[model samples]
Target: MATAAVFLDRDGVINKDKGYVSQIDDFEFIDGSIEAMQLLKAHGYLLVVITNQSGIARGYYTEEEFMTLTEWMDWSLADRGVDLDGIYYCPHHPGKGIGDYKQDCLCRKPNTGMLDSAGKELDIDFANSYLVGDKLSDIQAGQKLQLKANYLVSTGKVLCEKGAEAADGVFTDLLSVAKAIVNG
Candidate 1:
């Protein structure tokens, strides 16, 4: 059977969006973010992270560094009994990328490449799934996939009025979104 997932954006939704967060020392989970994942897990929603890591393409960090940080994050969440189903990132930037990192890849946000990959690899049912992100591009990606709902969380960057209006729902934080999903 296909799984129902709650696709998440990494920087804003899971951790504080410190620009180019490449080191473990700089990574900080937003308040209640871990608990929110736990709640979603308890409710049988597969927690998958889909993010655009343009910092890598821009030479701010290496893909190895990103993977190391991701490993640490997975372990940290495992300690809390919240196992992430998957993590998909786009390390390409059509502009300002160094070397081979500069290309218009399909995995970037505002595009559904990452989501499409997740759906196939994880057998995700898009119509039964949902997305929670901090930017307009995140919502747009989910919308393109025809997910059941797309939510905007305000923990990272501030959304413009137009961006907020585009979301199926808007909330203060990831925990709030989890509550709404679990209860409603």
Candidate 2:
């Protein structure tokens, strides 16, 4: 039997999109995020967080700091009965990256590298899975893999624009999207 997942874009979908959230103190969850995650998990969707951490490549923050915040977020979610099956991120910026981080890597969102990584590592049924993101890049990333559904939340840069056309659904936030996923 194949497994299905709900791929989430971390920055805006999981937490606030106040730019690069590197510090623990700066981290904050969106309202109903924990409950939504738990609901998805209860519905048998393996929660996978896929984010693009350009701050890591831009020298704005170190990968260690990113990892630290991520670990803290993971535990925070776990406390609420939302255990993520996987977390993947990209730390590359072709132009803004510094030194080793400077490169046009395929793992970046809108490239599908991260989705491919998750698909290969897990029993992900891409054609039957769902992706919820706050950016156009996130939609393009999963759509490239033929995901069952793609949703864009009105919480990031893509808002106020016609990003709705790119997604299967558009909502005020992830919780609304999760509601449809869990109930539908």
Candidate 3:
């Protein structure tokens, strides 16, 4: 049977959005994020990370560096008793990407490519899943796939009024969202 999932945005939503966070030293989990994942996991929600890493296209970092940091993040989360089911990222930037990275790809948010890929690969039940992101694009992406709900959290970059209005719900952070999901 397909599994319900909680799709997460990496930067801003999970970790502090320190611009171009490609190094372990720069990765800092937002307060309560780890706990949020643990709570979701305990409730049987598969955790999947969906992010836009345009910095790779901009040459700020390489894919290898990103992978290394991701490994560290996975390990850290595992140590804390949370295991992410999958992670998908878009390294393309239509205008600013360097060389091969400069393409308008389907994997970027608002396009639903990454989410679609996750659905197929992970056997995700889109109608039963939820998405939590800090940006409007993230909510848009989830909306396109008709997920159970899309939430915008305030712990990352400053959220604009429009972004707040676009989400199915808005919360102070991931933990709040998790609580809402688990309790309901």
Error of 3 at 53 (Å): 0.2
| Candidate 2 per-residue lDDT over residues 31-118, each given as its tens digit | 8878889988998998999999999999999999999999999999988888999999999999999998999999998999888888
* Candidate lDDT (C-alpha), each: 0.95, 0.89, 0.95
Q: Residue 170 deviation, candidate 3, in Å?
A: 0.8
Model 1 score (lDDT)? 0.95
TM-score of candidate 1 relative to the true fold: 0.99
TM-score of each: 0.99, 0.97, 0.98
lDDT of 3 by residue, 1-184 (tens): 9999999999988999989999999999999999999999999999999999999999999999999999999999999999999999999999999999999999988899999999999999999999999989999999999999999999987998888898999999999999999998
| Candidate 3 deviant stretches above 4 angstroms | none
lDDT by residue for model 1 (103-160), tens: 9989999999989998999999999899999999999999998899999999998887
Ranking by TM-score: 1, 3, 2
Residue 83 error for model 3, in Å? 0.8
Clashing pairs in 2: none
How many times do residue backbones clash in model 1? 0
